[model samples]
Target: QAAERLRLSARTMHRMLRVARTIADLAGAADIATPHLSEALGYRGIALAGTRDAA
Candidate 1:
């Protein structure tokens, strides 16, 4: 919803680290680790949300 609300492309919005940071915070992570980054990227597209979509 943030992507559409912000009028941002799914791809572009997906790459945004801001989303990752938020996810990390929600997960109570002390730092934005690789897992957090990967999880954040998952919400971007269907192709990688389940599979693998490395940036």
Candidate 2:
């Protein structure tokens, strides 16, 4: 659903997962949770803000 909403490619989705995993690791989480994924998406949004890709 997020991938569809963001129109993310497979590569981009994989990158997001990597970021989410890192976030989880930093939090001492054994696995990526919804919050980590949400945070990753929020960061992606922030990074894209004011850019042509921002929606």
Candidate 3:
């Protein structure tokens, strides 16, 4: 779902996971969740709403 929404490649998917994991760790969360993944993807140009076509 995250990958599809972001239109990212498989390798980027893995990178997003790692980044989300780190975010959770820094925030002292026991696990990665939707918001964590959301933020990570957002940094890579994936909006949560997915409505914007372009810049």
Estimate the TM-score of every prediction: 0.50, 0.82, 0.71
Best by TM-score: 2
The candidate with the higher lDDT, 2 or 3, is 2
> How good is model 2 by TM-score?
0.82
> What lDDT, from 0 to 1, does candidate 1 have?
0.72
Distance from true location, Cα of 34 in model 3, Å? 0.5
List residue ranges in candidate 1 displaced over 4 A. Answer: 1-15, 47-55
The candidates, ranked best first by lDDT, are: 2, 3, 1
lDDT of 3 by residue, 1-55 (tens): 7578658898989988999999999999999999998888777665535547653
The residue pairs that clash in candidate 3, if any, are none
- Best-to-worst ranking by TM-score: 2, 3, 1
lDDT of 1 at 34: 79
Q: Give the top-scoring candidate (lDDT).
A: 2
TM-score of 3: 0.71
Candidate 2 Cα outliers beyond 4 Å, as residue runs: 50-55
lDDT of 3 at 8: 82
